[model samples]
Target: MAGRSCRNSIPVAFLVAVLFVLNPPTGVKSDSSDHRYKTNEDVPLYANKVGPFHNPSETYRYFDLPFCSPAHVKEKKEALGEVLNGDRLVVAPYNLEFLSNKDSEIVCQKKLSKEEVAQFRNAVAKDYYFQMYYDDLPLWGFLGKVDKEGKADPSEYKYYLFKHLHFEIAYNKDRVIEINARTDSNALVDITEDKEVDVDFMYSVKWKETDIPFEKRMDKFQSSSLPHHLEIHWFSIINSCVTVLLLTGFLATILMRVLKNDFVKYAHDEEAADDQEESGWKYIHGDVFRYPKYKSLLAASLGSGSQLFTLTIFIFILALVGVFYPYNRGALFTALVVVYALTSGIAGYTAASFYCQLEGTNWVRNLLLTGGLFCGPLLLTFCFLNTVAIAYSATAALPFGTIVVIFLIWALVTSPLLVLGGIAGKNSKAEFQAPCRTTKYPREIPPLPWYRGTLPQMAMAGFLPFSAIYIELYYIFASVWGHRIYTIYSILFIVFIILIIVTAFITVALTYFQLAAEDHEWWWRSFLCGGSTGLFIYGYCLYYYYARSDMSGFMQTSFFFGYMACVCYGFFLMLGTVGFRAALFFVRHIYRSIKCE
Candidate 1:
């Protein structure tokens, strides 16, 4: 046992080392850590992407919509996370120097042809917004606006583009503290005509000193574009805590009153043992530990779930420690991809060991299933979304090179580690240790009431857990689907723990009820009971889509539903595994206490 423990520790230690080495504990940032600047030094401004106000994910390159560029345009190389976040940083035409101010400088003069005018008109009509970054601080502004002047008549509407930009840069000593991009409505140019028109782009820069420190500059952007509704966030947390307390109260009844009575009745009264066995859960002790059907699939699902659980915990920890920030491009997604690839060993070991315990022989097939269980579905969904992005010429479409790099990472790093872990697990395989002996002939299960059926039990079991965290789901959905920033990592971590506890307690209670009814098939039932929360979550997603959000059109709609499906599936696997493990522990403890012949 000592030797086996030591061997298991080796893989864990190596994983930790690799994680720290690959990704040092640095907060996500776009620029160098040094903030001091020399006088008259060039402050490079990078143009990012533009999209309609309603659809956050549907974005195009800054240069895609007829934006003026430098004569010798240079592309800024971005990190993996940045690319995944659809950030395409390119050098802008405007020239600004540190501590230098300019007045009404002409950026460029353009002759708008018929096509150019139409493109501008369409963009303005859709309420397009553009994004840019100066020294890693982001700026957003509308490309144009529609003037109705409170008139309902379509003929009374006029479209105009802002041709002048005013940049206000705040500096503290030698460091840039903050930057703001403002457009004056008086500087608007009429683009309602199709005739050839000469347009002049003008910009002015003002440098002002500020008392704010450079280190505290990010605090301004930390507040989300939308309201945080912090009181509601706390309300959700308190709601989940109350649900957990309620479930805990029920679990306490089972452990203290019900299970205690059963243990006493079986142990103290040997004379009535056989009679007692004829009635409740004690009757199914012989078959309760029977190896479930499709054990390989069950094992693989559990393995993947374990990995996801670990990944989620670690990600939140990282977020709490400031390794990931809401404004840091795609840092969270990048960490997810990298860490998941590295932790394939966990999945392999878990699946292989559990499958061996179930007396499964096809190691290779089990290994394949474990590896592809989550990644396969995610890859397919991403590919489909990428195809749509390509068709729409959106920035969300990943370049071919990035795709190849990801494939290489998986093939070279993830697959090999998974195989190694599988080999280790196979070498250290052990038999399943069930306290109750199984009879050669399977015991007959009695017919159950409609209310006691698996489907009803699953629904009942799932609803409690879902209710605990349903409120939190709104904030999560808003952050992902809208413009809100999720900065409450500590609250999220607390809610996560609550979710697991609620899922476990509810599943265990249901498993006891199922066994009490003489239904020994509790393995998958417990899992489904816990995982049914995902179904409710998906249902809520539908409600949120139709009633809560303004998201529409094919690209945004497909992207929302498709990605959400994958997310819910992950929840299913993760919570299901939690349920199964808790029920297994409960069964083993109770059965071991009672006399099982």
Candidate 2:
């Protein structure tokens, strides 16, 4: 405990010094601090060149996905109007292993296949069936083949039906090809028997020249236009605001249940010790000081929140650092996966230590739970989602070998750190103490009028704040990971900072108001303070579905992924803010109780 106290003192002192220097308390600047497109009233449909795709003099490169089938290549290329001859034309590659959106792959290199023509043909046709999951059917799947130049599995070959070749047609240009077998279709679901596959080879039917269209684009999340992003960001921001307020008030009601029974007076047998204690906050210092009733729950939440916050910050920083090079497309996730694996030490250490001390559960259970609760879920999500992508010939999918290596690293490196951190955290001192206080007996205070205890006023306080911003948030998540176009990340960065700050402050203020009003259940109220951000985000998504976005046939599975991601992000941010403030409140109350002034 002495060591823990020492560690905390240095950090607390450092934080206070930093806060004094920066004056961070008031709040961050509003959303407009960095928006390129000003005002929700006017949203421009398009912008001039800023990045690589808009740049001329670009080269067509080969995709390097392993296990690409030669047959699919021939069929796809012929559909692109390749005139078999000495004439050479740019074509996407068969194996698109490690290419980015900016770098196109060469998919038409000739190759041999030993697998039976019929069996292989059927497998190719039924690739979707090759991969399946509970309640999660794949939209599409394909059996890919790599070059077998130096191989013993030889087989009879069939001559090319037509000279195969294809080129990635960018969307902003006019159609330059005709009379080709276009197999392109953005089918979100598999085997929509009633609905015909509308095949079109033109730009509208494809994703960034690569076969794996939905890999890195945030569009799958937002509208492809700046106006759309702005619109949705605001919507989601508002939704979250409302959620924050509602939750803040809700939690207040729950916590105030303590007030319902005159908790300070009735619940304490420690009253006999009150005389030995100092004067201030003496009534219920021991038990009511931090409300130990939910320490287990609180610790779990803080663990998850810290993990998510760290992960998000890392991703944003990586983006700022240009890790997602134009030439390096789907590799963003690869980088993130590595960073995440490496950072498991932080997650494990933080969660294990915090949980062990707070929950007082077995240290081993605490450590394992901390590791698995976070890193484990991420790993599983990656595997399942990437498996689906691989089946659909989305070369961005992570390979089995990579997954295996990641797990090995996790076991070797992270598990140990988590165990140690748990031990250290368990031994740590509580950051704040409930002020020393004692009372001979409890005091009963009668409930105030209904208005004083009503949940309505606190709930209303969040509406304006929430209304102000859900649209903005909706577009950001959509734009970032939904495979949508987002050039104005600078603007997005501004809006994101503003939204979070506003959410935190507004929620806190609402909680304070309810407490003053004598409705003291602050737990859920604290959670809802930030939780409202989701409401605005989801609302913005709804608006896009109606007003801005035109992605009609996105599969149910995609919807599920999108929604789930939103919930996880929303809750994590909300709880982090709540936990931080509550910890602060605990400290303040403790000190006040001790002074008894």
Candidate 3:
């Protein structure tokens, strides 16, 4: 009985080992005081409160600030924040005009006409907000009473204002644009009832005598803004590497041994010219490549999967090269949108080609399905979340004009690319090379044991893939949902490679088991087995929301889950593609090696 208990415990012990390797606990203490906000001693005190200081070296270019117009304005317009409804309204390009001169000071005050004041009132009524960038950090301006500890009280929140706009331009050797702002009694404007508000602007310039290079100052600003987690990131990567190496060694050894034995047996049988054959995967070669029943859906999945695969690879490569560094607000989102739009051609070509090979006739329908499959769900979710954000007066909500721009990008740019790719794919010949000819009727799959069934196999296959990334996922969640700054793209790239390998190996292992059980219908099973990792990831998100995060608002919750759904969908596509390709290669290699004429 003791020996029997020991044997039963072996599987549990192995599972615990894998879990430990995947999530090695960091030695750092989890004390709340460690992360509490600390007052920077270097910051200058104003009225017993410390205010943010300007880093002269870092300069940033300003973009258009989004404003919602009242029912009077025929169309909404986006403009520079400095020009909108500030104490000192200034126009674009000229807003930073001070940067052109090295040692000059000028003060100009402009009075707004009745029409302009009325427009400003209308903008305030419609909840106009400013988007300000200094260096790479986003600056948010709010009007409220400040407490003794330098904290603004939410109860005293009155209105939104862009108080002080200071531009510092240096021309020692090269031109640079630097900006910093401070709030004072004179800069505050109360717009609670949306009445006609007059605006007057005064400019004061001060030059600091310093010899620091602009690049060095910019580097200093970046370092201060973003969090530094190099040690923790390396620790997580080492753990993940160990897990991946173990999995790789185990898979390589098992596959080689099994394949070698099978090859030897088959070769010996061929030499003896035996009529009878083995009773495993060799018997199912004729039906292994049989087209699945839902060919169109399968084709669409493969196409979208391939498109996401390409997008993820390119985005990571760009990030590794520092293209989407945190210094640029919204740069990553812009890059993803542009890349996804351009890669629509790849999606179209893949879907059309696969559908054609499946004997599909409607090229137009296939093309539409391929493009809409992933984008449709994403757009719908985004629209729903945007609505919630707008209702809550959240700055994260996108304006209608921006939505139109996104629509135009999808329709004008992405649609044309998809059409071009579909035309090319439809005109090309469909060549599917199968060693054994498919039978007229589908092969009957045998009854699988409960442990080997679809759900169980998917659960087992998904756990390892999810485990490989759950540690990194925690950091990502903190970055997205908390105040953490994530800048470990190199480690992310490494973990991504590991995720692909683990998914591929596990899918191959699961496929082998299914085939050995005389179950040849693996088209969807292979995809789902590995793709289920996304389901696990979604579950973890739920856990984080309830257990780890302090989020409580309805809008925040809705937006979080809404965007997470889209994330999981992309993960499903990517991992599903990896699993399908791996299984396909496994099946083809196994059948091609056997003499099944």
Worst 10 residues of 3 by lDDT: 43-52
List model 2 lDDT by residue over 216-265, tens digit each. 32233223345755665556545655665576566657646644333354
The parts of candidate 3 lying over 4 Å away from their true place are: 1-131, 134-212, 221-228, 271-277
In terms of lDDT, the best-performing candidate is 1
- Candidates in order have lDDT scores of 0.83, 0.40, 0.62
What's the TM for model 2?
Answer: 0.50
Judging by TM-score, tell me the better candidate of 2 and 3. 3
Give the Å error, residue 177, model 2. Answer: 22
RMSD of each: 3.3, 16.4, 14.4
Best by TM-score: 1
Query: How displaced is residue 243 in candidate 3, in Å?
Result: 0.8
Q: Model 2 residue 489 lDDT? A: 51
Query: What's the TM for model 3?
Result: 0.70
Where does the lowest 10-residue lDDT sum fall in candidate 1?
21-30
Off by over 4 Å in 2: 1-287, 325-327, 352-361, 375-398, 436-469, 477-483, 517-525, 535-563, 566-579, 586-597
